[model samples]
Target chain A: MIQGNKKKFNVREIREQFPALRQLIYGKNLIYFDNGATSQKPQMVLDAINLYYSKDNANIHRGVHYMSQQATNGYEDSRRTIQNYLNAEKSEEIIFTKGTTDGINLVAFSYGQLLSAGDEILITAMEHHSNIVPWQMLCERKGCVLKVAPINKKGELIMEAFDALLSKKTKLVAVTHISNALGTINPVKELAKKAHAVGAKILVDGAQSIQHTKIDVQDMNCDFFVFSSHKVFGPTGVGVLYGKEALLEKMPPYQGGGDMILKVTFERTTYNELPYKFEAGTPHIAGVICLAKAIEFLSSYDMEAIQKHEIELAEYAQDMLTTFEGVHIIGEAKKKTSVVSFTVDGLHPFDIGTLLDKQGIAVRTGHHCTQPLMDFYKIPGTIRASFAFYNTKEEIDFFISAVEKSINMLR
Target chain B: MTLEEKQQEIIQDFAIFDDWMEKYEYIIELGKELPIIQADKKTEDRLIIGCQSQVWLDSSLENGKMQFYADSDAIITKGIIGLLIRVLNNETPEDIAKVDLHFIREIGLQEHLSITRSNGLVSMIKKIKMSALMAV
Candidate 1:
């Protein structure tokens, strides 16, 4: 239904594509507002998953059998799809990973090989733990210095602080494209430019942004861009790590295994070329093929219309929440995505989340794995209701009333 | 009353409520009545940090009976904790360790018992059991 209309975005029709959204939870229609964590997969993606496993189940890259060749083609086709999705210079730059964390760790380990002791790695405060910990481990292993750029109360990155941290010693600057906990969108393009000016490479954590906005690695000019496929309506356990071909060639292979090596002996081992050098094991074949289908599904939509719909839903939710006393919305950035996080006075987020769950409204409650960000706000956590394009204003209205009721019950 | 009888009493108390809202409202009221743990007892060692909420459990042995006092940042958790204390309090440590408090599921809050619930109730129960086991 959504594929038929290219220009107009009909959310109801789009919602119909996701089978999981139509189900009832606890005798109430499920109102899923946890899109920031992960998105619901479309029927096409599910069908693609089933089709791959049913017929094309074979080890890719080396199998001489027709099924193996077919699986290999499917896997390579997905890499090309991701390369196109990110607008990368070459398909070789798109390496399949376990997920966003694995992608980041790959870069931190492989790229950290290039950095010397006392060389600095810079990151922002709004980053997810995935983006932070890899660089921390890299620093520890390589004797490199890790510096954090701060954020303001609005959850926006402090560009001045980021600039202050950038220097000749700063070999790499890693930042999230969007704040998962707060929905604060960081200006990766500008940050990339600044990082380059200091002769430092930049890595953009696109896990949260890839689903909400258009991502062009070439345009952004970030040396590395990483995102989880599951967050973008794809299958779990697969992700994409897009890097500059030149940079990837210079870095050591991430893992040693069957596919990643060309020749191996007791005394000598030679690695494979480009992507296979990093993709060591037999990959998640079904996941990769289905992720391509997910990208194709997303490509059918007018992204501008989808973004508009989602942002409006978030704005409407934020506005309604303001009417209630002692309801403080976290991360009120000017360029926020479809996420509204807030806490009610004298009420715990866990209590509110439990009540909302009983009403069949799924929201994320707690620190959201960004403990440093929560500490900055001096909050235990906030109740986050993240929206996707499939969500409606009516659902937000229901959520607001549910929140009010939850507050009343909690008080 | 025996521990089983105490659990039955809670089951009966919850049986009057037709829906989850009524049951939870009563639980919230019970939360209000939960005796607050001493502020000094809210130490790091006593703290059970669930991803969703924080629970502080302090226990003592009073004349060979287990006495459990607990508090949580979340009221629903505290209410559940109050129910836990109600059934298990004044029982011998051996009995507290062995008791099966099935009223939680009978009352339709089986979700709380799940370790994945992220409300510290599972760990809270574990801590209670460990304390009882240690005393035993």
Candidate 2:
């Protein structure tokens, strides 16, 4: 539905939309390449957030008054907007969460009961701690086995190894669609199919992929998917969890609170239906509404065109970084997203990151919550520059020059 | 110099740098000049957790004077520790414990005060005081 008659992306026009990007940092034009961590919000999103609190300021799903009705309608309309965005079969399957971390925890708790002793839950070496830890906790609680699928030297998941791990005992396979640290895109659709063959459910961690690529849950046939809105240029504390109807209908409610209940009596309290049962309490009402606005902003453009632009930028940056003497770019996957992670020889990522900060170049340098991946690569951490469509080749040229200068100083 | 005098000296020393770049170069120079931590003392127990960059700090209290030997995987962190060490080293535990590290702010090392680096900085200060507290 997002695909339609679209104009060619104008980096100048798009850059104008984000007011934060218009400012200066340390006497240099701000060059933000931390999109993998979080993207800057467009003016439309900021305006929407302001509009919500200023005009429609009421808790959703609880009031019968006009303002409350309007608020509730806006909130549900957000769910429908997102439902259309992800192309989920029904709005009932979409659950709002605090972020990717909270979404994973909810699934871990709600679905943990399905696994028993000796049941194997599969994950990958490339998962963020969010995707890995919840299953680790679930395995600990239920006496299940947690198996990690290994990756190749190029940071791609080994499909043969993954196939070997899947069997009758394999109860679930949870993996990231794109590695936050490595930027390696997993063949999630094929993996999802393989997971189902062994009677195991699969979960695609869409935290990185949701913003960079298009998602069709039906076409992919994954059992569940989770993503954060903030990474896609929306506000923080807002995330989405998409679960198939049959599975969600079977699972119990995630949290106990005001709106998640049908009735609360001392004698007996029953839970509400799907989606609402998963979403607890007075949610990030304003954040979700603004998130829908962000999605609306995204839908205005051709996502395919945006994705292509981002990929080209990343490729160009990667090519430039490779030419630097003693510079190593991590995760050379055959298929990747708009992220280039690298480390200079004999220089800590922290030092490079600090120097880059002085020059107003924003990049993330750490284990990126994927410490296992770092251990595999035999490094402490790498400097990551992630791109968004709003970025331009001119910015990349400036980034390369800054990085080269920073490296020379550190050396 | 007294601990306050030393901190004041550093504050005065950093005021000459016109921009962040020069100030950073000075910090990096300080990092390079940090007293070497004994290789044996660089064990896991001496390692400071909760830091984005790995840090190892060791303390020795002899004849009521405290000495801190530290190293970091990141140069900026090492430089930060060097700044702390310059002021606190060779002072009495009570003096080290009581002194406020005002030079950090006065020198405009605002990046060290940021949320990401603040944990490491605070822990370093706490460990310094803890080493002093143990001797007392």
Candidate 3:
């Protein structure tokens, strides 16, 4: 069993929950540090999936049969569970999507289609490609101008520049709450408020933030919030987009499909209600049902406890990483999630990632879909070790030791 | 033509990537073959944006075929460009335009490439193709 600081939860107990984590890679226990990309699901989440497929499999919301009612109830219950997890006012505001990318594209296509020429869309330089590309497409199509809020050398958002970027002509401010590449936890509440003051709608890409931090959308008061279920230990192919009821009502449906339309005739068509209008066609029913189980697993553990445990692990990893000669950690922001982005002097990031993988330590390396940020740092790419609540300090120590060995060998 | 026939014809004209691992080594060796771009050409105009490495690419079209001159501060990234040029060079603009180099996945390079290298390969191919289109 993995050894570490003994806490309320033991490593063995936690390890038992994830069957995939038990597998050996390169004859060593897997030390997964790519949580920011996608997390491994626990048995509960997996079981939920199996149960849905085997016992409750049916098309939802249309049939009067028992299986259909059960499936529909399970599906809707998952939506309510997600609503409670996000603390949204109502379930109608939550629209299921494929993932964070789809969520952002939905908003961009629906709301961005309304934007006229000369309208401005403000986004930070630290955003993931998911946040950046959709807006760029909108700008190109609408003849709208795209404005970027730059980050300081420390990889923190330049709040002053963000404020300056907001203007009367700025129609939308789309930013990531937590940067996937840099691990910078942006001051999204303040940024959202500033955008609202300038009469711009705000779309917070909470893909990274929702996994690590406590999010109160009501308190943030952003117009739209988006997150992926996979990043939060749920199933892939499912995500959430929480839009305020008033704004969702005004926006047109993104895709013209069976579920999104209320009535269709030869000449005229009327759209469905708010969330359904956004959710087109058959959804990822099994993934959605299993997402609720993942949420339940997360809710059982106090967030503060999880944050405390992860912060300790991150700090330990950072200290150990700094001890290696010629190792420089990128994005030294005062506020960050448990992600350490670093570059070794003599070795390329790819070489480092490959070497580490040989020892069963999995870390993400490269631009991480944020080429613009890599350009700012003036580096080829970084080796990113992102942590989750389940990751232990001993695993981080093993990671550090492996890195030292790899660097020594490579050099 | 059949897939095999088309592949054989292409293979006859250019080096086949059938042994991609060996080809990778050859590509890296080709990075060594590249004549260094002059310090004067390392200006903003030659700089390839969105690369993790400080890469500068410049190309000239001769007799309707593209020849690329590229360098990167990172050796492996430079090697990636060499590999890209090997596939992309000597092809007509129309042929290059028709090829979906995303089929690099078939060579099993995607699984091996770091995301940056994958992206760099993409950019390098795009720049070379765009240069070809411009020449045409």
Interface RMSD of each: 0.8, 1.2, 5.2
Look at candidate 2 and give me any clashing residue pairs: none
Instruction: List model 1 lDDT by residue over A303-372, tens digit each.
Output: 8888999999999999999999999999988899999999899999999998899899999999998999
Candidate numbers, best lDDT first, in rank order: 1, 2, 3
Lowest lDDT sum, 10 consecutive residues, model 3 chain A, at A1-10
Q: Show where candidate 1 strays beyond 4 Å.
A: A1-7
Error of 1 at A119 (Å): 1.2
Give all TM-scores, in the order shown.
0.98, 0.97, 0.80
In the order shown, what is each candidate's alpha-carbon RMSD? 1.4, 1.7, 6.7
TM-score of chain B of each: 0.97, 0.92, 0.65
Worst window of 10 by summed lDDT in candidate 2 chain A: A1-10
Docking class of 1: high
| Residue A347 shift from truth in candidate 3, angstroms | 2.7
Q: For residues A1-411, could you state the per-residue lDDT of candidate 3 as single tens digits?
A: 212432354556766798878888857899999998999999999989999999999988778999999999998999999888888999999999999999999999999878899999999999899999998999888899999999998999888888888899999999999988878898888888898899999999999988788888898998899999999999999999999999998888898887788899989999889778998888898988998899888777667777887788888999999987899999989998889999998667875676677688999987898989988998878999999887888899899988987676555
TM-score of candidate 2 chain B vs. the reference:
0.92
- Stretches off by above 4 angstroms in model 2 are A1-4
TM-score of candidate 2 to 2 decimals? 0.97
| lDDT head-to-head 1 vs 3, winner | 1
lDDT (CA) per prediction? 0.92, 0.88, 0.81
